[model samples]
Target: MLYFLKHKLVLLATPKTGSTALEQALAPLADMVLQGDPRIKHCTFQRYKWRMEKFIQIFEDEPPQTAALIRHPEDWLGSWFRFRHGSWLNGTTRSTRGLSFDQFVDGYLAEPQPAFAAVGQQARFLTHPKTGETVTHLYRYDAMSEFVAFLGQRLATTITLGRLNVSPEKELRLDPALRSRLEQRYAEDYALYDMALDKHPG
Candidate 1:
């Protein structure tokens, strides 16, 4: 995550939503950058709320406005499948080496997900567990231009992003039944994405 104290902006890093690229571009301008542990690096809004409360106590200032990205649920899962299919994760429980995209989704939909398909939910990451509210600002992963323009206007800097943490190319076709199931299960994420697209149609 990147925190710009002067701008009172906290850009939450939503995994597989081009966060690495944004971090590379904006880290130089951020007052604070956290990327050491995957846990802290991908810290969700619910978790960050407590951290920010303590952080702002020193300054006696309100917490910064927050933002994050949400990708199409199926595409997000596809990225995870391809990412874990890499040789780097071979032989590990997290590896998706032998699994097809459909199998990965099946595992994900299971009550107890297999390690490879155990990626956390985008809706949950952006949501406040108690309040069921999301971030102040949200952008779609496929809509990078809108997100970049917002950053430029908010931060008053021309931001340029480079692709990072890109997964290998693969044909990830989900079964019709599985696709429907994904949309049904992740309806909140789909709604949030639609809201973002409507709010920032540019």
Candidate 2:
């Protein structure tokens, strides 16, 4: 799908939202891959902010069409917390062990940091960036199949739907108190995600 575009597709990956799946699926299609810091699977907010111009520069010659994959704030944050601090993977638990989700949310809210800020802040670049105009097409992690179809049409190529990063089958049961806290913690992100979801093609 990306190979057909050659230089026309720029995938600005957002972390922990099935970005790896998208990367694997589209790797064959991309002429150049812009993998971010190894510490972060995709671009951190700081990195994206600092290199927005360079990213824009990549599109100068042919003016590539851009796309990004995003996830719901609650789910994305949970995955990020688990991946960064929890025991999901072996030997990756040193930094984040024993940190409560509330504590993590509090720390994220208190600072202007990369990878820990609100998901809405991370997603703002999809619509508006400090350096340049925002890209038009975006894919919500929740609606992968529809996004794949949309991409297929735009790129005039076939895109196969693959395994999502988060499984819907095994639902995370959050206590009411915790759910409310999370909802409050990510209110802005919820609103932004709603707007993006509304804009998605039916």
Best by lDDT: 1
Q: Estimate each model's TM-score.
A: 0.94, 0.66
Q: Write the per-residue lDDT of candidate 2 for residues 168-192, one digit (tens) a residue.
A: 2322444566667767866756666
- The residue pairs that clash in candidate 1, if any, are none
Deviation (Å) of 171 in candidate 1: 0.9
Candidate 1, after superposition: displacement of residue 119 in Å? 0.7
Worst-scoring 10-residue span by lDDT in model 1: 193-202
Residues 89-180, model 1: lDDT tens digits: 99999999888899999999999988888999988998988998788888888888888888888899998888789999999888999889
lDDT of 1 at 50: 71
Score residue 132 of candidate 1 by CA lDDT: 85
Model 2 score (lDDT): 0.58
